[model samples]
Target: MANSVFGITDENGNFTIELPSWLHATPNLEKACAVKVIQLPLDSVCRLRHGPSSSHGIHLSSSEDGFRTYTTGWIQLQQHDTK
Candidate 1:
């Protein structure tokens, strides 16, 4: 998941997306399309080790098989470091 994007963005927030040779682009995504990019909070990320992760951000069970079916719980920030 990490180290996927490797391009410098200009001041206008525009950059060329060059995927590695190992990665493949889906036919539908080959052309410019409206993509939904999600950025999870630092605490919600599993590697942060904030607390006992309950189902990774407490999602609601849904019949949809896609990620849109999942949702995160209320943002709960701790006052101190976990370490």
Candidate 2:
């Protein structure tokens, strides 16, 4: 995963994460491991963390099998009610 800067979680519990300066400036940068955009059912929400610092990186355990990827800046995640 690409190195990421720190992020802030608002009082409303909304997280605002920023990509590294290089990635931000060049949105077309090829995918490394970091996710550019993701939308999951509230039920699917598990744990969120910055990738590891040493080597193994942050371990993400999820019930979902995997994710689908498309060209950068061209994908839109549809929002639906999980209830």
Candidate 3:
């Protein structure tokens, strides 16, 4: 596990999280933690992004049956709505 840089949580169970300088620049927090965009292709959102494209990474995808290149897990989950 990653070493905790900050102190423990308070009585209210609130703790401060100071992200890295690179994380601060990232717009999407979810994608920020997991994705790393190398050799950036045509992105509809970050087309005008500055600095090296390798600095940012693309989203990950997997096949349900381990055959296809792209996966629709999130979309399928949304459609099924098991909740």
Candidate 4:
């Protein structure tokens, strides 16, 4: 099981990573089943921290006529850095 990474678009059209519901069910995500979306400065580096066996991923979707549509792909989280 591996954690994944994902990106979301901000008001200014810039992209940021988030760990939404989709990521929770990932193979190794149970450890960090709860997730939060945090916003930072536009030029700052973003970081994701998780415990052992925790995973992160993202999904993109849209709703129309009471139905939801999703994109086909997801980002992958390969490793963690403890600094």
Best candidate, lDDT: 4
Task: Give per-residue CA lDDT, model 2, range 10-50, as digits (tens).
Answer: 54434445445565444434434333323233663332342
* Ranking of candidates on lDDT, top first: 4, 1, 2, 3
Residues 63-82, candidate 4: write the lDDT tens digits.
Answer: 58844334334322233344
- Model 3 per-residue lDDT at 23: 53
lDDT of 1 by residue, 1-83 (tens): 46345444354433456545444443433232222223334554333224434323324336354322223334343454467
lDDT at 73 for candidate 3? 23
Q: Determine which window of 10 residues in candidate 4 has minimal summed lDDT.
A: 71-80
Candidate 3, run of 10 with poorest lDDT: 70-79
In model 4, pairs of residues that clash are 3-77, 4-56, 4-77
Model 2 stretches with alpha carbons more than 4 Å out: 27-83
Q: What TM-score fits each model?
A: 0.26, 0.25, 0.29, 0.19
lDDT of 1 at 45: 32
For model 3 the local lDDT of residue 6 reads: 41
Task: Give the distance in Å from residue 81's predicted Cα in candidate 4 to where it truly belongs.
Answer: 28
Candidate 4 residue-wise lDDT at 60: 35
Which scores better on TM-score, 2 or 4?
2
